[model samples]
Structures are given as structure tokens and as C-alpha cells.
Target: MLRKHIPITVSHELVHFKQSPLKKEHTLLSTSIREGAAEFIAGLISAETDGTLAEFKGKEITRLL
Candidate 1:
């Protein structure tokens, strides 16, 4: 079970790692963007629809961003 999700987990953490060095300070918006980018990148790489996370790949958040 855990192993199956490792790819997604690793991708998420990789995004964080890539962004970590550039950030000067942590803030709510920056954290949200980091987390959101992880999910978005993972989804793109996987190319499979995960019902649990599908709700996020929508227009609502896109408009806000």
C-alpha cells in the first residue's frame, strides 16, 4: 500500500526540495504554492486520474491563482 504511493510521495518531496533553496522566507501562500505544485507535478507525471485528488484539478483554484 505504502509502496504504491511512493512515486507520488517522492515527486511531491522533490518539488519541495527544488523550491527550498530559492525561498527567502516561509509564508502561508508560499507553502500552499509548494504543496499545490507537488500535487500538480505528480499528477502530470502519473497521467492517471486519482478520484481522491481529482477535486483539486479544477477551475476554482486556477482562477484564484
Candidate 2:
């Protein structure tokens, strides 16, 4: 589980990095938006690649939502 999560987490952070330059505040709102978008993308990728969105479920995803 933890192993599977690493890639998704890293991908999310990477998305934030790509978006960071355009973001102004980097405040809670910005952070949540960046992270949420990343997580959604990562979930999509995971579902496409791994054939399951199960990794995107549970506590972490719930918290993001």
C-alpha cells in the first residue's frame, strides 16, 4: 500500500511544482487546489495504468476532497 502510494504522492507534488510558478499566494486555497488537481490527475493515471482507482480511495483522498 505504502509502496503503491509513493508514485502517486510524488506525481502530485510534481504537479504542484509545475503549477507553483503561476500561483501567487501559495496559501491554503492555492495549496489545496494544486494538491487536489494533482491528486485527481494521479488517480486518473493510476486507474488507467493499474486498472484500479482503489489507491485513490480511503483516508488520503477523503481528506483531499
lDDT of 1 by residue, 1-65 (tens): 45677777777677778875546777899777777877888778776322274656664553543
Clashing residue pair totals per candidate (backbone < 3 A): 0, 0
Clashing pairs in 1: none
lDDT of each: 0.69, 0.65
How do the predictions measure up, each by TM-score? 0.58, 0.51
Worst 10 residues of 2 by lDDT: 44-53
Report the alpha-carbon TM-score of model 1 versus the true structure. 0.58
Give me the candidate number with maximum lDDT. 1
Best by TM-score: 1
Tens-place lDDT per residue, model 2, 10-65, is: 76667777774754646888766766687788777665232355866764644543
